[model samples]
Target: MNTRSTSTFGHVALIVAHCAGMVDLVALPVWVGTLIQHYRLDPQQAGGLVTLFLIGAVLSSVFLASRFQRVKGRWVAAGGYAIAATCFGVLSQPLDVTTMAVLHAAGGLAAGAALSATHGTIARSANPHLKFAIVGVGLGVFAVLFLGTSPKAIAAAGGYMLFAIFGGVMLLAALVCAIGFPDPEREATDRQGAPVAAIPRAVWFGILGISAMALVQSMTFSFLERVGNDRGFSLNAITGVLVVLGFVNLLPAALAAFFEKRWSARSVLMVGPVLQALLAATIMMAPGFYAYAAAASVFAAVMIFTHTFAFGLMARLEPSGRAMAATPAMLMVGAAIGPVLGGTLVKTAGYGSLGLAALLIGSLAVLCMSRLPGHAPSSLAQEPA
Candidate 1:
């Protein structure tokens, strides 16, 4: 194939990999009410399901990070999706709420595997810097916001069936990617199945950035959904808010090409939390719906920019294939923690507290961020300079 054609195919693989990672969380909001009604679960208990998923993810990342280093990237990706797919199929059955939560947790374990493995795959591929950005856009923006935000048939009798379909598609995509995409084993590791030893300080910083952002996001997004409902927003209106939020998220990444040249990665990482605190304050002070929407939009913009820029910065820090491959696994640590913190907060405090808590957390994250080592300009940033 021509270079352009190869690049196009590679981009397709990245998007597919991202979509697989995305299905784990995107449909969550849509299922929230249905899970409550069907399972007869209280708000706190229903929220626990998400917490359980996080627990499974955290444990999996801890244990499997090294083992994944020993295995072929394709196999890891395949196993994660297969397990997730099977769990989703089980969930489609008429089980008690407890059973459903357990099944979801099982799926979470699978998702953790897929997520770690796909990151490895992307990192080892040719021109991985571009691939990382693509993953951010495809998974972070399009798959997450578009497919995840789409209203599912959660309230319908065949809701479980819909979930099953969702799982099946993810599984199918994983399988196809595994089969069609080239193996990353050659690039990801040296002989004897060990990744290289060059660890970049900026990678650690990236992990810190990801962890902080995920926590604030979980707290705020979960809170916004619940509080908006409390404030008498219709489900349709809530959905509209989510859609707008997703679109707004695309803004920062869209302008990343411009910002990276002018600003340091540290600067980009710092913008998100500061903006989020401002937005959270706005939401707290504003009394009208339009004001709330505007706040949400600004928050989304900051988050997207932060996540994309930080991820790109991390990829630049690590030059070895496998070390870079492990970056996402490290980053997932934050992802796992975020939802659990948010769920616990919601259980204790009212939804209003979510924003307030995030504001404080964001402030602290900014302080911690100053201690992290800085990264040099990414290749993208160097181009056209």
Candidate 2:
């Protein structure tokens, strides 16, 4: 019954719960592909599903966490998992597009609340960068397993059934871990449920930086295969590049976690954006197979470094945790907008447009990082919230 005693279990449980919720966005391509085939729909029509999901996710992340952040953790976790499982089950049933959209939206709401609660808890850890890295690793492992099992599930039952089954499993696991979470009241110290505009100006800049980073990432990554083709890469070569890039993604988080004490968060924050711009330029200029492969690998590594630190910054920015709660929403919102932006660029010029766009976006992120309260030398890892 003691909150302090549950620290170890609470940490692990938060990681597990966050990963389960994150899988939806992390594996968007697979889910969207399956949906397109199942419904005989165009990419645009299927894409609307993602938009609705983000809308639900953003709404709940901001609304619920802001109001009830002081509520008990177990209640939030159990309630969220229960809601997600129920929605996924209903989502598997035969329904019109309108009906399906509503269920998906409900599922997103549950996921956002669950993710925010867990992530906000982790944000308070003694070493948030390390905890965030663990999140990245957990996601990587889940991605491999999800992809491996998904085909068989899809073949035997259907894509819809896969969601129901996974939802059930996640629900059970989350329920078991319900008692492990530490006190939400302590994790999220509400400023009497403060209004949105009450957030510090510096924190707003950090949020904007994170959103811009996500925008550049999704925009480039979404059409990477097409970019490879445009660069005259063979299909197998492109697959090889991405396969290696996948493994490369795991390293940065591990490295960042290990080096947490050694590096200043501000140093990492500033350096990361520059590296991102450089890597994006490499893919643009080199125009060779090996260059693309190398750039992709480096980009993956740099992202985890930046993403983890930026996330930690938000946690420190406001102990009320409202800013931290919006992370999932910001990421999804940026991702939802990226394709349209990238698509416009591609139509106007070529794949080179992505490089130019990244250059501009990365610059904006750097400028935003400058405004974060912790950007000063000594305040590197100190809590600014």
Candidate 3:
């Protein structure tokens, strides 16, 4: 095929891989609720299980990201998802908590490796922000379908069906990637053919900012269903909120893409955490259905919109793609703590405490974002070789 055709095909593969790898965005609520209701685990235990998965992802992504230049993206993407699919398939069987925990961690590790490869390739593309937004739009579409149907299906077929669906999605991603995942051009090298300089301190702070926001996102999101159910909202009502959330999810990435040149990335980054904290507060503390539904519906959009800009900024700051390759670690490191921390807070201090936690964490996010340099240096902005 021609270069244009190959590039288009690679974009498609990246979108599919992104949607498949980031299953937590669409599935976390159901995943946690299923464990609580069907598997008979407490909030902390259920959250801890999810935390283990995020921790595994973080560990693997951190390990692979630094070596992104040397690794083959196509094979890594194909192999990782295939292994993750197997882990999820096994998880579908009736198993003890210990076995399930091991499977969850293993699956997360495999999936994170694939995500690292996928994101590294995107960072190396001609337009990292636009590319990330395109994939985000794809994920939003997946969220709509997954949210609209998965609940009723799980209700009918049992919680194990969730794992089955997860396995199926991962398997599909593996197949697609194996057939056509693109190998982007490698990062720019020095005269000695060495990789570029280390990632800037400012970029690290930007990453930390995104990670903090992710923690807040996951903490509140993991309990969205439970919060509604506990407040006596009907299943249909909660599901309606989720469906609306999914539809809402479709807009942010497109909006981010549109606003890319218009808005300052730093300004967007600064506003995101504040909006995230406020929405999270409303979702957790609202006494009525409408208030909770409204807040919950648009909550995920904040992170989606903000992260697009942050992803672009990081790509600019560290053009080698090493920092972007660490995307899973940046996202999941905070996420690993969120569920368990949220659960502990809910169990001890009640849901209102989540609002307080969000405030504190969001402040830290703002602080980190504030530290980022206004622009990438000339040296860091050059295209990778």
Among these predictions, the greatest lDDT belongs to 3
TM-score of each: 0.83, 0.79, 0.96
Model 1, runs deviating above 4 Å: 1-7, 31-33, 67-69, 125-127, 140-149, 156-162, 185-195, 280-286, 298-301, 321-332, 377-385
| Per-model C-alpha RMSD | 4.1, 4.5, 2.3
lDDT (tens digit, per residue) of candidate 3 on 17-97: 999888887788888888998899988999999998899889999999988878888999999999999999999999999
What does the lDDT read for residue 266 in candidate 3?
A: 88
lDDT tens digits, residue span 1-385, model 1: 0122234554566567666665533444444544555566665665667656655665665566555557766666777777877887787788876787788678777776766667665554444445565665664465334433444445445456556666776677577666754455233334546756656565665566566766676545544655666677777776677677666555565576456657776776676778876786666446678888788655655665676566556554553444445444444455455555656666787555667776787877687566544555444232210
TM-score of 1: 0.83
Clashing pairs in 1: none
lDDT of 2 by residue, 289-357 (tens): 887889865665676677887776665556456677677777766666665565566667776877888
Instruction: Give the Cα RMSD of candidate 1.
Output: 4.1
Candidates ranked, most accurate by lDDT first: 3, 2, 1
TM-score of 3: 0.96
Worst 10 residues of 3 by lDDT: 1-10
